[model samples]
Target chain A: MAHALTIHNLKAQIQDKPILNGINLEINSGEIHALMGPNGSGKSTLANVLMGSPEYTVTGGQITLDVQNLLEMQIHERAQAGIFLAFQYPVEIPGVTVGKFLKRALETKISGMNVSDYLKDLRTTMDFLEMDQDFINRYVNDGFSGGEKKRMEILQMLMLKPRFAILDETDSGLDIDALKIVARGVNRARGSGFGALIITHYQRLLDHIRPDFVHIMYNGKIITSGGEELVRQLEEKGYDWIKKEYNLIEEEAHEYSTN
Target chain B: MDDKGIVNTNKKSVLFDYQLNKTPKSSWSADIRKAAFQSYTQLSWPTPTDEQWRRTDITQVDIPGYNPFAIDGAHEIDVPDSVHALSLDNIMMRDTALFQSTAVPLIRKRVETATDIFEVYNLSFFNAGYFIYIPENATIQNEITIRYNFLGTHALASPHTIIIAGKNSSTDITIEHSINNNNVYIHGLTVFLHENAQCRVNIVQNISKASYFFSTGKVSLSSNAVLEYFEAHTGGSIAKTMLDAALDGSGSDAWLRGIYFGTGSQHFDLGTIQHHNANNAHSRSYYKGAASGTARTVYQGLIEVAEHAKKTDAYLTNKNLILGNTARSDSIPSLKIRNNDVRCSHGSTTGKLNKNQLFYLMSRGLSEKESEQILVQAFFEDVFSHVSGGTADKLRKIIREKISDV
Candidate 1:
């Protein structure tokens, strides 16, 4: 059976300042959606608020995964419910080896998983991602390059096999080669039981990882929704045409940037 | 009376009782004990005005309130034929005729350097004692293990351990101390490393929660000798230890590492000194500890280089983790370098758990408790990596137990 994630009339804020004015979206398994927006347009805010980030408060909203309430669940519970967020800045944990940390995480997520089977899967997934076998013994993100950190995030997503994933700017600092590797890792996990929300600033990433639907966000709200043609249009004319089409004032849009 | 149930008592009466009830050893041993007792009488307990006693308060600990001569337990000593492990009584009584020609002089010469009141008390009235000696040019293939298990309540016990490494010899040794019921335990240890010797010593102290513990040790190294010393302090209501090492020969190196975990209302005070008196000598000391549940811990470290010791290198580092709002820790690292061409540095850090780090782990589907357990264990990995495998596993088990109890 396919699971669906529904968000209706979502409003959120950080401290007293409002960030997400109102967001309405629905995603089901076996589909991928691309969310493109300029800087400070509440793209990242929506992703973080979906993951129950303590920094953001949900002023008014409703979010549900199937029959379970996502807003009422804790951050870790959301993760346990098959919601994964590939962070923009992966935190470094010193002295915690990648192999050990991932194994523990897998055990917690699937308490009855067979150790031998998990080990075999880990080996195969790492090989598929083109990660060195010795990389598992290295400390988690400690002294890792930017590309390595991003690859580690994808490796975790594949190992955990979440139902829905939110890729929050995972391609910002990657070169073309690394971008290809990351896209390959995500494509390997794409199937009937998987869904993804890819947040990006450029259409280059959308070229490799094709999306079924596209949405453009501005001023903390989704102003337009369309098919893949929207990505090409934005790449050609940039966000200025969208601003001009929406009749948005220049200073009013720039005000969110200062915040 | 304080929480430990200690009350004021006459110190003189307790000393006289111990002297009357003690068994007779060799004539020279008796003389040494008598001299130590005389010196102990002239000294007084450390007051809060003293620098070392400023953070820890012991005004209510009266040594005479408990039975000084009560002892109840046996020790397990495992060693190879290359090593000579003798009880202090066996060496001082049965082997008296050969005492002067034996290795007893190495202990006697070092024991005379004690000036602290607790050190003198341990020397004057030690109920449990052992002497370990590694002969010349014999590299023992097996490790030596010595364990002292005491199960007595409301008792005052003193234990002494002396180890000597002969010329060009090498060995690894572990000494463990534990108690079941409430008691006052004062311990003294001395080690001598002769020329071209290598020695590694690990000391583990895990006493009862209601007990009081005090320990003093000095390890001296000769020319081209190397020593690795590791200590773990995990138990006891009040624990204080003073461990010092001196590099008395050129080209010698000493690496000292220690870890401690305190819970409940326990208190711990740990001090170490790295003294360099020879040219081209190097030493490093790394100590880390964690405290929780209203507990308190302190680490005082010093690196001293003499004026004549040119090209001396030393480093000292201390890190502490406070597990709760009320738990506290203090770290003091100092360096005194007299030579102009020496490199020495010291650093100390104390902090709570990183919230970002915790959240990162939690986001991987682990609960708050599981995340904390992983992070706390990771915090001590750097220090544990330097220890032997079996000992490190055992220490990690103790830390895991402390975290689970929370």
Candidate 2:
């Protein structure tokens, strides 16, 4: 049985500041969704909340992966349950080399891979990401350039092979060459039992990895959702039109409340 | 004062007397010992009220409960062909050609009384010790190794070592202190590097956690000499060590890397002083430590540049990782620079494993403990890289073992 992530009326906040208000989304095991939003419109918050980041407190909502309650598990438990987040700003861990950290992670995520085969696969992924094989021996994201950090995030996703991955602006800092490799990593890992919620502010990434569904997020909620056309409309209008439309909706609600 | 110091602890005096009577008398060392003993007798035991000994309290430490004697004999450790390695007592027992060539002058100047009381005790009652002499312009390919193993019911064991590298000579030396039974452990070391000499000292101290361990040492470098000192301390219930180094020779260089792993209720106090005495000398000290389980650690490092020492470069860094809520680490790194032309900097930081780093590892599916263990190992890797041979690997193995119990 394949897994499907269902988030119902999700509400979350960080430091008592509300980020996600009544966010409802679902992605089947084989579907890819593009979550396009303006800056500070709760896209990153949703991804972080889905991974059970301790910084984000879920004020109200129910999140489930198939029949398992995702909210009931700890952060690592959420990872073990197959939830992955590709951070926009990856952290640097001094003294911990990339190869060792990934090996430990893979051992827990996919325990059956032996050392020799794992090394081979890791080499392949490094090669695909246009990274030097020596990088696997370097400290995790320690002193890495912006592009390298983003590529490393995608490389981790490829290694973990999670059932669902939320890529939060992973395509922002990447050049076209690096962006293709990241898209290629996602493309190869797609379908079967894998799904992804690709969150971004631009349609450039959607051009590489097309989403089955598209969503427009504003004011901590998804005000509109559609297919490929939605991405083009937003990219052409540059979010100003969406802001105007959401403003009209807010004005209508306010007037109705007053009457 | 002697009676006042030893008479109250008669059991300790009997052990000390047996040790004193057994040491074959040599006028040179006897005079040195007599002076040191006088200082030791006059100086009262330091209490927690005193600033230097404030972090290290000896109220619970008992001297009479243990014994001390000759713990090493002839051929107890194999001596490589290219180096002269023998006990100081043995040299005092029989005046050897090597003694005349190397030991006579260094022994006279090495183990005299210092300012500290415990070091004064080391100068007075070191039960056993070794002296290794590397001949001038000679290179010893094999590392000269020595061990002082405490066995039987010894209440106190103080083994000392003095290493002198002759001019233009090069060698590696490893001095390890270990114990199979419970006792108070104290070892002393004095290293002398002559002009153009190059030497590396690897000191590994791993006593049973049931004992209290203390080590005090001083190293002096001559002109154009280079000394690399590494100390890896892992065991002992309560451990304290002070390493004072003087870069006395112009163009001399010194590198000190100290790494320790403390767990349980252990209290570890590690201190170092880099004294820049000559112009154009370079010295660096990097100390990394971790404490978990109710353990506490204190690290005090100082880099002092004398007034006449111009163009000297000295650096000191102390990094400590505390694992649990009950575990604590205090790092105090200071500098006293008297020369304006010198470059000296010191920094100390005590922190836990980064929570974000922990989450990054945990997000990769590692348990919290596993994440912490990896980060802890990573935390010490900076210092481990300074260690060479199988010693770094050995330290890594011990760290893993300790982490399993942390």
Q: Pick the candidate with the highest DockQ.
A: 1
In candidate 1, what are the lDDT values of residues A11-74, reduced to their tens digit?
A: 9999998888889888899888999999899999998888888889999979999999999998
The segments of candidate 2 whose C-alpha lies over 4 angstroms from its true place after superposition are A247-259, B1-14, B26-32, B70-79, B88-93, B141-144, B152-154
lDDT of 1 by residue, B178-201 (tens): 887889988888888999899999
Retained native contacts per candidate, as fractions? Answer: 0.62, 0.79
Candidate 1 CAPRI category = medium
lDDT of 2 by residue, B1-406 (tens): 1233454565444544555666666534566566676677667776799877789898777653455553432324546767777776676677677666665465456545376767767767776788888889999887777877776454567777888899999988888778755678877788899999999999988888888888888899999899999998898888888898899999999999898888998889998889899999999999989999899888888899999999999999988888889998888888899979998888878888888888888887888888888888888888778767577787788888889997
lDDT of 2 by residue, A55-168 (tens): 988999999999999999888888988999998889999888898888888878675769989889999988887889989899999999988999899899988889999999
Per-residue error for B11 in candidate 1, Å, reads: 4.8
lDDT, residue B308, candidate 2: 94
Instruction: Judge candidate 2 at residue A187 and give its lDDT.
Output: 95
Query: Best by TM-score, which number?
Result: 1
